[model samples]
Target: MFRYLILIMILSITLAGCTEQVKVDMQGAGETIPTGSTGIAFDGKDLLVAKEGLIAFIDNIDTATAGSIYGYEGHFYFDRYPITITSKENKPYITGLAWQNTAGNTGFIWASDEANRRILKISPQGDVITRIPLTKIYPEDITFDGEYLWVVDSKRKKIFKLSTEDGSIVSEYLSPVPVPTALAWDGKNLIVGGLKNLNNPAPSPDNVQIIKLDPVSGNVMENVETSRYLTSPAGMVWINGKLWISDRNSGKIVIISDKGEPSTDIRSYKLPAVAPVLKKVEAKEDKNKTAQDVDEAKRAAEEARKAAEEAKKAAEAAKKAFELQQKK
Candidate 1:
């Protein structure tokens, strides 16, 4: 009986060695602000941006918590933003950021380390909870649809649905777009951004498109031409009833309204919040006021003209009444 038990224990040990368990690094690493941001995610209240080698969280898009992690500074469109960063030993290139509720209310930020070929689960407070290695595929953009996490494997030409518990692949299929760059969930459908045509040297701005697809079957439901002027879109998110996309080359974020026809109501960021140091003119009244003032002046002029017309009609009526009395 003892000999039989020893043989069974040896067999179990051999099986365990065959499969590698994911290493959960609780210590985390040193923090460094990324040189550039590539992806963005919103966690109801805060906005998380994925930089090349770091993940930054902006508490309310306007303000951030101050500390070591949040003290790291970075420039967005020439303006300085107080950004919180995620730490890693040898900062691997990160491309995507997605909010997941794997740990209940605390929440977790899912990041795709493209260079290292792995996915990292980080706490909202900048702690690296765990990492799942993707040995073969290169992940670009990632999106979470309530239950499962989906990743765009750019190099493999595939989109994969991964288990949140362990970054194990649940299912994967060929992407409808040849070179998919951005992914977003719009309540019911998965919206993907890709190049319309392969321009040999580089993709043309006019050929950029955002395609809506069935999350399960990956069928093209709608193809919306984004803009004839936008550079290849990098990150996309549905926020405040509009689709916000970032251009890869220009590093500018553009807002597109959800119109039935291909969106023409597109707006691009003109400049950063704070002007450059040398160009720090006065407090500078709101640029929006100029447009508003023109509209207000036009409205006042219109009202004055209407009043004058009404007054002229009243005088004419009085004059006609006087004439009728004289005739009587």
Candidate 2:
């Protein structure tokens, strides 16, 4: 009998361990951008998002409005009438963008159009100033240093510095590896992320290695170890000395401090499963028991059950709300 009781106790303990649940508390929930969105840049207070054929300027980043631009489409300036720029007969999908002041009057925004294999120079008001055709390379991310606009070619695994005034290649530096996704300029150095081996059949790990590159020579200066929680980072921008990355697969945004520590600030919405409603479990089983004892037991059990029910209901309500919001 003693042996049997010990065996039963062990089994019960194992079952209890198996039933334990893991909880993940998120900081900023219900904040997300559209799928397939790649590059993001902040313009002081607003945010610029590049996705597919559209480049939109969001006036408010805290409360993002979908498919809305404060200025005109294909235009850059936030004030005055909208100026539409012609693509110079090339309908390239714009991937990355960077702003620079060339002269006192003229401000230039350099945008890399990967589809047409060219980098375009546009005026502040969205006029096609010039387009520099790139051969044997596909440009992905772009950033502006003090003098030049640095562009990343993921396929060629090279970083090219182009003149902000005219679309001319100033210098080109070959990267150590392939699959460069995002670029961040830290005043002194450039940080690159998004490493992937497409040939491998198995799924790649979630961890993305952040490599710091010397802007002048385009050589690897140092590498920062990132969190293993990120699956694929598509866009990254440095705000107030912190690096913010958007995970494409998870539909979430992660904030990484200058020290290379990462934390998830956004969460993706998931639908709740349908379940049958059940009656509340009662605690008062013995009618002949003392009134006070029965009352206390009933109240405790009712409170516990009510708390659990409220949690489950809240989860379901959140799921439903998310689904409804997505439909809009």
Candidate 3:
């Protein structure tokens, strides 16, 4: 009987050992950041990352994060470190960023501030050139189509075309779906994707599908579904003819070929932990409520398990004592 029990224990341990570990392919070469990395852009050589309200640049496609943009040669990368240009005003919750070079001399960075419902144009030197007021409540994503800037009104289920020069809204188009989270332009068509506020009770589809649309008319051209590759697509950038998309919830960036085929996963570098600041009252309240509920449930489960074990041991001991008395 003891031998049989020991065999069962061994098998149980073996099965537990065989359980799959979180098999993250760490094959693609890049760095990993904390939780919320929403935007990624590549300028020929280096890569740019934007999270929260800060931007950072990296040199080697493999190197994830760089400290300062100065002294970096080849392709200039942008970092969140306040340069003379971005340091003067209050830092906005920057979600989307696009850069355009006019006349090959002056470069402008178009950034979207979701919290402020506005977009700002920053010069290569980091100076805020202009701020465009947006009627959309939450402008989560932004992209450029050579001549115009496209902004995603995530909460309003709409897309707005704004003049790159003054941030003036040229036109707005209602999205056929809900929650448009990301935007990309393939020279001819604009691609958008996010959760479909579908009626089904099951969670919205995990796939990241692109809605190809005419850049001029804002009319849907075709739907390209990306289920096998992307989980939840957020920010995207077209680099060297390939599309690089950031998966906001999955902590991954998927690279798609110009033909819209899944190519490789862009490597993300691990970023240094930033000090946690409880600035917003609502954020703090939500944190407290979540912590309290989790703690209470954990404590209750532990207590119940402990009581069950104690009762089982006591019962075993009592049975042994009674059996010995009977023998006596």
List model 3 lDDT by residue over 1-328, tens digit each: 9999999999989977652222223223123332355766554454556676666554433322223234221222223343322323555677777767678655677778776777878775667788887774577778887789988876777787778776766676776446788887777877777766534354334534576666555456665655444556677777766676777755656566545443132321112334646585667889999999999999999999999999999999999999999999
Q: Please, what is the whole-model Cα lDDT of each candidate in the order they appear?
A: 0.65, 0.62, 0.64
Q: Write the per-residue lDDT of candidate 2 for residues 27-137, one digit (tens) a residue.
A: 232124433456666655545566655555544334222233542112122223323333556665667766664556455666778878877777656777787777756
**Residues 1-328, candidate 1, lDDT per residue (tens digit)?**
9999999999999987653322211111211122235787777765566667655555422212223364533222212232344345555777777887654577878888787778888777677788888865688888888888778866776777787787777666666667788887777777778665655466577667777776554456666657543557677777766666666755545556543343332232111233325765555476677778999999999999999999999999999999999999
Root-mean-square deviation (CA) per prediction: 24.1, 35.1, 28.5
Candidate 2: where is the Cα deviation over 4 Å? 1-31, 63-91, 101-107, 200-207, 217-219, 251-253, 261-328
Q: State the weakest 10-residue window (summed lDDT) of model 2.
A: 71-80
TM-score for each model: 0.58, 0.56, 0.58
Q: How far is candidate 3 from the true structure (C-alpha RMSD, Å)?
A: 28.5
Query: Between 1 and 2, whose TM-score is larger?
Result: 1
Candidate 1, residue 97: CA error in Å? 0.5
Quote the lDDT for 99 in model 2.
61
Candidate 2, residue 220: how far the Cα is off, in Å: 3.0
Q: What stretches of model 1 exceed 4 Å from their correct place? A: 1-36, 59-90, 102-105, 259-328
